[model samples]
Target: MDPSILSGMRGFGVATIPRWPWFVFLAGGMGCLACSSLSHLLACHSKDFNLFFWRLDYAGISLMIVCSFFAPIYYAFFCNPYSRLFYLASISLLGVLAIIALLAPSLSTPRFRPLRATLFLSMGFSGVIPAAHAVILYWGQPHIFVALGYELAMAILYATGAGFYVSRIPERWKPGAFDIAGQSHQIFHVFVVLGALAHSVATLVILDFRLRLPTCAD
Candidate 1:
């Protein structure tokens, strides 16, 4: 066997996992957007509609958070089945808890806005654990650092969005000032979209990086 051929083989030994992360993110994003649009459009129709739509809207947020974990964890641990399974299971459980907590009748009230935001934010922040693990495992790789930076940016954007959603700022500052265009809720939505986009970018970067990492049997 040629030495160069052996070197080439070793260099290309990285594991390739399926692309289910992107699919999970796409589905979750669509679900959240659809629910949000429906809630906004029909909530004014009746009291029952208002209650139901709002609950769906909150549930949509929780669903998105859970789904957001799929890509990074799946790609980061592609060669490490144990870590991948553990992280996936942990996030799935968190998502279920978030959905149940948000769906609770009492927790859906306007008075519980901060509590709701806190729950979602906590779920999002949970990514830090897996992210930190990825860094520790791949500290020598530049792609891991790059992905971590993007993930951090996503977290900041999300936390900022939650702040706007919870505080009702700007709108509260000037009642009806933003009723038509720049309401805090609208701002929150924009930030949420931005955060999701950032997450997608990070996931893709991690996926590409994973493609270059060594495989399990290597």
Candidate 2:
């Protein structure tokens, strides 16, 4: 691997910023997957376990959304310290809000599924401001466009996933017919993974662009 691709610590020449964004994402993803698997495997064990595990699963999803903002925003806005700080702060605040909102027992019920999906989608869509800023700030750079393209793709995929999640698609149409193979939830999970991978690629592209730019001290 290129050192530039992996060097997350040196944010715009600053060594103080920790390089755990990727790890944060990975941990979030793993936690989400683990929670989901456990929920499915053991929820049937009892009603209490079912409720608790499902809540854990929702928390894991919220965690993944929070972590997902780290890499792309960090790399794309690295050159503009104030912009970077603002975007990071905004997303962090949104993440906290999402967590708190989701944790409300009333909101966690099945009837509020649409509300939950909307909350998460809004958090993801909040990247638009930073993304637009990135493009405007780096208008002439090829990597900016490339990264933006990937980010756009990521957004679309995520939105589609949220649609599936909110609509409950095939499962809703055919009830127990899709209980095993073609459920909306399963499709939504696939899109979530794809969106994350797309974001990762975009982050790497932004990081490469940062590597080529002169340092802040220069």
Which number leads on lDDT?
1
Candidate 1 yields a Cα-based lDDT of: 0.86
The local lDDT score (0 to 100) that residue 76 gets in candidate 2 is: 75
Q: TM-score of predicted model 1?
A: 0.91
Give lDDT tens digits, candidate 1, residues 1-218: 36675466565663235677879988998999998999899988998888888888999998998888888898888878899999999989988988888777787788999999998899999888888899999888988888888889999999999999989998889897898898888999999999999888899899878766566675
Residue-pair clashes per prediction, in order, are: 0, 0
Candidate models: Cα lDDT each: 0.86, 0.80
Q: Extract clashing residue pairs from model 2.
A: none
TM-score of each: 0.91, 0.87
Q: Please give, for residues 61-174, the per-residue lDDT of candidate 2 as tens digits.
A: 777877887777887766677887888788888877887777676776889998888888888888888888888878999999999899899989989998999999988888
